[model samples]
Target: MEWIILALVAGVIGYGIVIYNGLVALRNRVRNAFSQIDVQLQRRYDLIPNLVETAKGYMAHERETLEAVIAARNRAHSAAQRAAGTSGADAGALGAGAVGELASAEAALGGMLTRFFALAEAYPDLKANQNMAQLQEELASTENRIAFARQAYNDAVMTYNTRREQFPDSIVANSFNFTAAELWQLENAEARQAPRVSFGNR
Candidate 1:
């Protein structure tokens, strides 16, 4: 009877250890995923100015849209800095905040880019410019990468959240300060309402 009781106790302790370790691993994965998203976003930021300059020469009348995109980019850069500092604490909130920053900036940039293209339709010379075409293609590709990175970040958060919310793992997570990761959501609710009509007439 003594030996049987001791074996049962040992099994429970071992199982608990496994659960704790798994939770830790999942938490780390979430952090790493966020870092990857940041790296890609930074790459996109560096590309923005080059894009702005490329678009500028062709469309002098697009001053307002171009300015908005630049302003949004600045705000996104600031928010990213804040997110970096407070990582692992209310990570969901921070991730969401960062997403807000990047999304807002990207939206402004996208809007301006659309107008830039539409305006380009009127100017055959601008359309035929090698630099403009190349920049446009690169910008499109970078946007795709940003989207993919966001998906990866969400996937990591989902795995971490699943473990954190599970029965035995929740106990471990609570004791160790590991918590559920938040999904990055759009900050602008109004933008969700429509197909996003351009500021200027089509």
Candidate 2:
């Protein structure tokens, strides 16, 4: 009888330990995913200035668009900092919708930059500037990295969400207050973006 009681106690302890460790692993994975996003965001922040300068010389008249981009970048930077500072909070400090709006603004800014480049094509001098070309290349690369990071973040969120919704893990997660993560979803403007169809004049 003594051995059976001891065995039961040991089994319960082992089961609890397993649940704890599993939760920890999932939490760490979610964190690592966020770190990946942070790295990419930092890269984007670093690259934005050069991009702005490159577009400035070429599109001085488009101050409104440029200002919008800068404002959006600032908002995104602030939100990211807040989200980082708010440790263990399930609801984002800046709210998920705000973050999504900032992301949409970045996309709009990118599209505007494309328009700037198209405008620059008319000016051979700007296109030929070595500095502008380099900045453009770096900005393009940074955009690609951001896309990859966003995909990774979404993947991590999915993993975290799955654990929160699963069987034994779900119970443990609730007991410990583990929450699901949000993905970088496109905003309404992004959805409303019409497909570009360039056709020769009829």
lDDT of 2 by residue, 28-47 (tens): 76666666777777777776
TM-score for candidate 2: 0.77
lDDT of 2 at 33: 66
Could you tell me how far off, in angstroms, the CA of residue 189 lies in candidate 2 after the best superposition?
Answer: 8.7
Most accurate candidate by TM-score:
2
**Model 1, span 72-176: residue lDDT tens:** 667766666666655666433244455555556555555554555556577566667777667666666666776677788888888888888889888877877
Q: Estimated TM-score per prediction?
A: 0.76, 0.77
User: Per-candidate RMSD vs. true structure?
Assistant: 4.7, 5.0
Clashes of each: 0, 0
| Candidate 1: worst-modelled 10 consecutive residues by lDDT | 193-202
